[model samples]
Target: MRNAPTVRFEAITQDNWEDCVKLEVKEEQRKMVAPNWYSIIQAAYDKTYTPLSIYHEDKMVGFFMYGKDPEDGLYWIVRLMIDKRFQGRGYGEAAIRLGLELIKRQEDCSPEIVISYVPDNEAAGKLYERVGFVPTGRIVEGETEARYKVLR
Candidate 1:
């Protein structure tokens, strides 16, 4: 198989919040997101979660928010959204693979990664499965979530 594209994650900042805010998800898909655009951007400022700007070739194309799950010892991918304009390319997969690589590099943690999304999101389910994440048969906070692990 061809190698996934390189992706870099930079911590989110106020200067880039607008770029994230303006990210468009199809109206039909908006229901899958939590807290809406305004709340998500607001939370980013408070540092409750860490937001990462996904970049490929110096272009900002996607955003993801995540934090460590203290209970499970897994890096939780809380939010991952590609700009509507940038969707359908391979950026999502590239970004996800890069995230997994980052987890592998964390010395404090082992290679367990977990992510959750609405069950109806077929595209996300397919992407996660494509990258080796299988359903963990677990639900969190009322959302159907799946878990995946990278073998050490």
Candidate 2:
């Protein structure tokens, strides 16, 4: 059996901004992600949100941002992406699980986790479902994004 990738989550910082900016998504896939990747790093560094770099065996491979939805108390996954060069290597799934684990470490945080992604991106939908995320029938910014909750 293939060994599972080792994953670690670290808060984004100035030192790591370059790594985050250097990550790329294919032209076809860019619309499905946040319009500003650099803003994600800035937000995290500015303390506006929690941005995490996903490292596999010490190499930065992916990123995720999470925070409480101001309108609701539930945890929300604001942004998630795997570097184009690192896609299809199972790093995305590992990074997601690592994010969930990190959220669980917080006190009084909701057991539920929610995420939004373009509905047309079948690959993303499959990945989310394969990892136990289900649709919540909610739409935002006129875009269809599936919401998922972690069942403990």
Candidate 3:
């Protein structure tokens, strides 16, 4: 069996923004996360949000945007998605792990890293849980919130 490709995070730049926008989730998961374009749009106006393209070797195959919440100083992984063409290759999980590492590099970042998923996306819940995130029993805007207490 072939092994999964190494995943790396790259800043979304104008030169590659179009590539980021073109990433898409599976049809059945369309409702679970915002479209890639929307994520790019949101990152544009949100000073705290940082959008990143997930690269597997030389190809962009997924997207993730995360940052600190301005309201209360908490960090949040607002969006993460692997394109339909790249799903099931372990990219999403690898991206989140790298995202957490990025968060760790930020000064004054809160110990609790937050993320949310559609209630029905058990796959998302499982993936995050595997990285030490646990549900906080909180729901905002119909999505369930979970926290990863980073030990640093």
Candidate 4:
């Protein structure tokens, strides 16, 4: 089998925003994550949030948004989703790892990184756990929260 394409993160820009919005999760997972268009729009109004597109080689395959929460002063990975066509190829994990690197590189980053998903999205829970996240035992807005403690 051929090796999987390299996964990398790119900023959601005006030139690539349309491609980013075109990415979609599987039908069964529609409720598990927000649509890219919604996320892009939200991020546009919130300067703290940075929306990014996940690319496999040169092709856009997913979308995620991360930033520090103004209300709590904590960093959060508020969104993550791989397109239906790219699921199960390890793109999600790679993207998260890269995202963590990006966040950790921030000079003012917090010691913990937070993420949440619909309580029933076992796949998301497993994926986050595999990357060192643990449940924080908090449910906000109907989603279960988990955190990755940033190691020094």
Candidate 5:
């Protein structure tokens, strides 16, 4: 079988904002990550949240947002979601890995990148652990905090 197409990231721009907001996680995952619309709104109103549109080839596949907690300088993945139509094809994994790469590129960024997930979201937990994030036994805004090292 031929390998899957590589994933690419495009910074969220007004030109394609509508396409990005249409991306959403599965219905069952509604609680895992906030809706892409919410993220887009946050990105617009929150200076720290930088949203990116994830694409495979030329089609949009997901959405990702991250930024530093300005007060503490802690890196944070504010949102990540594979479009319901694109779920279960490894797009989420590819998108997340790419997101991490972008975070690691930050100048003066924290050594540890942070993300939080609802405790009962096992799928999110597994995906995160599989990608090298480990639970810090910390909670932020009612979600469990997981951390990943980011130097490269």
Candidate 6:
């Protein structure tokens, strides 16, 4: 039996930005999450948005962006997408756990962290719920809003 690769997060710097932008989801899941390039570009204009690359061992397998939402003054996991080739191997959940841990360490992090997804994205809903997020019954920009509170 083979061992699973170690998962970790790395800053999306100029050296690895291009590689991060090249990661993609499966065709049917395209609408469920924003593309890496768009998220990276969006992060550029927003200082609060910290984009990070998700790596399994030394291979970049996904992208993550978590930050404070200026409008609500709450922290959010704005984006998470594992490449099509890496889906279903537990990378998503592992990245999310690491992301949450990092978020809780932020100097200004709120007690609650938010995340949202298309109403029909069962995989996302399940994934988020499994990681401790509960739907808040609010829709933000058409996505179902959910939140996870940092437990002290």
Could you say which candidate leads in TM-score? 4
**C-alpha local distance difference test of each model:** 0.75, 0.77, 0.89, 0.91, 0.85, 0.91
Which residue pairs show collisions in model 6? none
Clashes of each: 0, 0, 0, 0, 0, 0
Ranking by TM-score: 4, 3, 6, 5, 2, 1
lDDT of 4 by residue, 1-152 (tens): 54545788888888999998888888999988889999999999989999989988789999989999988888999999999998999888888988999999999899999999899999999999999999989998899999999998
Q: What tens digits encode model 5's per-residue C-alpha lDDT throughout 1-152?
A: 43545799998888898988777677788877888888888878988888889999999988888989988788898887888898778887777888888777777778899989999988888899989999999888899999998755
**Which tens-of-lDDT digit does each residue in 19-138 have in candidate 6?**
998898999999789889999889899898999999998899999999998888889999999999999888998889989999999888898999999998999999999989999999
lDDT (Cα) of model 4? 0.91
The residue-by-residue lDDT of candidate 3 on 1-152, one tens digit each, is: 55656899889888999988878888899999998888888888887898889999999999988989888788999999999998888888888999998898889879899999999999999999988899999998899999999787
Tell me which residue pairs clash in candidate 2. none
What is candidate 3's CA lDDT for residue 96?
90
Q: What's the C-alpha lDDT at position 19 in model 1?
A: 70
Model 1: residues >4 Å from true position, as ranges? 1-4, 35-48
Model 5 stretches with alpha carbons more than 4 Å out: 1-5
Better of 2 and 6 by TM-score: 6
Q: How does candidate 6 score on lDDT?
A: 0.91
User: Across residues 1-152, which tens digit of lDDT does each residue of candidate 1 receive?
Assistant: 66667778887676776776677777788888753365466554755456788877877888877767667777777878777788877888988888877767777654667888888888898899999888877777766777777677
Off by over 4 Å in 2: 41-48
